[model samples]
Target: MEPREFFIEDRLERFRLKAFCNLGESGLGFFRLEEVLGMAGISVSDLLDLPMNDAPNQGSLELRSAIAKLYPGVSPEQVLVTTGTGEALYLAFHMMVKPKTKVALIWPAFQALYEIPKMLGAEIIPVPQEKAFLASTWKEIDANLYILNHPHNPTGKTFPDAEWENLLSWFREKKKLVLFDEHYRFLPGEGSLGKTGVDPNHSFFGTGSFTKCFGVTGLRVGWLVAEESFVQRARSFKDYLTHTVSPISEKIALGLLENKESFLPGIQTRVRNNIAKFTSLWRKLPHTKDFTVPQGGLVGWLMLEPGISSEAYADRLFEKTGVFVLPGSNFEEEGFLRIGFGETEERMAEGLKRWSECTDLI
Candidate 1:
């Protein structure tokens, strides 16, 4: 069956290649192969000797084991490593959603979270960020599944642990499945929400990747954690899709995971610095109406003046300046812009300066 156009990705496909300052990109700047190898304590000789075959259908045992260690009490048997979080989300949606299923989707999320279910004929109920954090709101809706992004995309809002616990309990009591995208959950001091163990009852499925947190988007390493039976079912379904991740990617991801301590500090420092620079610059700009300082992740949700449409603003900015920031329309909303600060400090500063110049023209 044919799926509808994926708006955000399609938009990116058109301009991403030529954009001088890609403020729409969601991940931190990439890590070079030499740097990654150095952090992992692996030499070029080790990579040269790695097997060229596809990894196990689920994932290489060592890779899966390393992923499992991120979550307390989780075993490799409960993990299914896929090409990236994109594939993991696809698998989860296919396994859990069906025609007429009622899904509560957290809004302003990555398009895939809601769009795939909509394609499957599931009845979707949009839950705004404000309502999602409150237990009172969940009481009003009857849903079979709840799809959410923690350290949410675009907004970067994260609920407190108590709220999450309450929400999870409510889902458990209602027998609703929870598919949490924790791709941007990693930050300084605080670890990912996915680090919480998957329950044996199969109530929660956490999907994440190395792309956002560790700046290894090229590796395309992502995984899902759930009950063993759930993982088995998802793994079986995976065979018909991409089947298995490339062995080379799996080996590299394994090294990254094994040496996370060596790499994370520097990555975290860069991200924190960029965020500070973006926030400070944005607050002083004339066009800046309001914005949320992202608690985690690379993007900041920015509201422009009431009369300004984010789409038009972004387009004009791209034409006048070479910088790009995603319009809220890309996320099926309007009136806001998603400003990403994932680039280096210098690049981010230059992009913001260009944006300021574009605003002057407006």
Candidate 2:
């Protein structure tokens, strides 16, 4: 299948070779397999020595039990596990999206949501941040709303609680489908599973990864949550794709989530602390006013000084300062760049310092 080559991924590939601070990383950094081994109450050497193809396929009881602690209502039957949230969403799209269907893509968002649909020849309707639809955009109230209402790559710009209710009501009227990616759902105080498009007929599909909340990237463990039927169909697709997730990875994810109450509190502290440092450095810089602080998520979006294109700024920043941030053009927004505040406070501050110094913006 001819796929639209992901520009961001391509740019990231080249940036890796020359990058220093690597602040553009999306997830909360990574954890070593040995660390995971210890959490699982097992030995690293033994985990490494697992028989090749003999590992269990569906997942282990230890892991499932752990996951159960996270989502008390969500049983193993309800979870469609995969190599990563990427695979989970891939399978969900393949299962739910008809060939040539049109998908509503939220702007300045992850590329995979639209990229995968495009590969299937599905029409991508980008929900332009400039003019987001009213009632028709979501589900409930705006009579002037338009098209099938589904949302992917959430921008954290939803209407308020009452407004959201009206929208949901509007969507229910339209029988819309919302593929919500709560990847950045860093809600205040142990953000709970959101209730955006909770209607079953809404065909709401949610995808998340352990890489974010748990700070475990290499685990390759994430999931797609939907009603039971969707789970079954997606699982069928997953069975044929990568077959199944690693039993070992699932076990580790389970352990972290098993004590999610304990685990997430620490993550919250880290996020708050890092963002504080980033804010301090950002405010100190003369040109920092070009960007706004985000409400949730690890990323901060910034615009360069009026005279500079992000492409040139990013190139010089990396080459001279050994710091890196993905240029906005990669995300299809020129003159803009994305930063992750999930790094060490020192590194986040240092990267900003280097950017200001290298750009000669005292």
Candidate 3:
């Protein structure tokens, strides 16, 4: 069957505060906005009173500069803001992938990569994972258009620079467009969409979001980086789609960007602590499930014992534990379950205990 993004809604709701790590959701995690606000001290009175009729210039300008600072060498012109990474992706696919266009997507990726293009009627060639895990090597897809995941979902595998370079060259040689998802770009030293000043004619586009990295899911903000021409086309589509982002949210996000250095380090510490806990727990357990310890992102996948289908196991676990999690079936694979430790420390500890009770000790 032509594959699609794994459906995870049922699993999470069914499970009792599931240990689901499939999607990049940081459960019950909140930005320390209060602390940040105190520092900004930019009171309601501080808002540069301007018309919200169009995208608020008050927030967007500085926000762009902030992004430029984080991702050095990338100009603000390359960064096109949208309501969320989802919107950025929707617009990119809508504008770029036509009915006859050939598309390649990484397996175990977010549901949208392949599903969106297919929905747009593009010819899809999915690079499904080899049996053991969700994210596989580049060899899986013979053709070139690469929909990639650095710190990929479900598996939490961060492709190394060497691999990224190889893939970049391959795409360039084959003259294929790349749609890279840097939703988890907060990972230190994560790969970029292209080499410095890489030509957009060969390298197509990228979508990055603050939601996954900054715990700002409510902000629903993301951006697209490509050649200026590509940005122009996407902007045209976006103008028709949502027009622009919320003026107020853009302001808050702008403030956060202004002080990311102080903020992100703390968030990273929280993520690292939770991951450390999960790593320690997994080491003791004998589920025989193995996966990469993510370098930066917030999710991972576990392969179940042979002959025990991930679907059946995940279903049974949810039935008994009320701890919901995404199964490998959701990623169109078998013998695996996605486990997220991106939740709060309490939830992480409690979820681990529940998981041991349900899986290993039982």
Our model 2 lands, by Cα RMSD against the true structure, at 4.1
Candidate 3: give its CA RMSD in angstroms: 4.5
Q: For model 2, state the Cα shift of residue 146 in Å.
A: 12
Query: Which model scores highest in TM-score?
Result: 1
Q: For candidate 2, give the lDDT of residue 344.
A: 60
TM-score of each: 0.94, 0.82, 0.81
The TM-score, computed over Cα atoms with residue i paired to residue i, of candidate 2 is 0.82
Tell me how far the alpha carbon of residue 283 in candidate 3 is from the true structure, in angstroms, after superposition.
5.3
lDDT of 3 by residue, 245-268 (tens): 887667777776776666567666
Where does candidate 1 stray beyond 4 Å?
188-202
What does the lDDT read for residue 129 in candidate 1? 72
Q: Between candidates 1 and 3, name the one with more favorable lDDT.
A: 1
Compared with the true structure, all predictions reach lDDT values of 0.79, 0.61, 0.63
Best by lDDT: 1
Please give the distance, in angstroms, between residue 26's alpha carbon in candidate 1 and its true position after superposition.
0.6
User: What lDDT score is found at residue 305 in candidate 1?
Assistant: 72
The Cα error of candidate 1 at residue 255, in Å, is 0.7
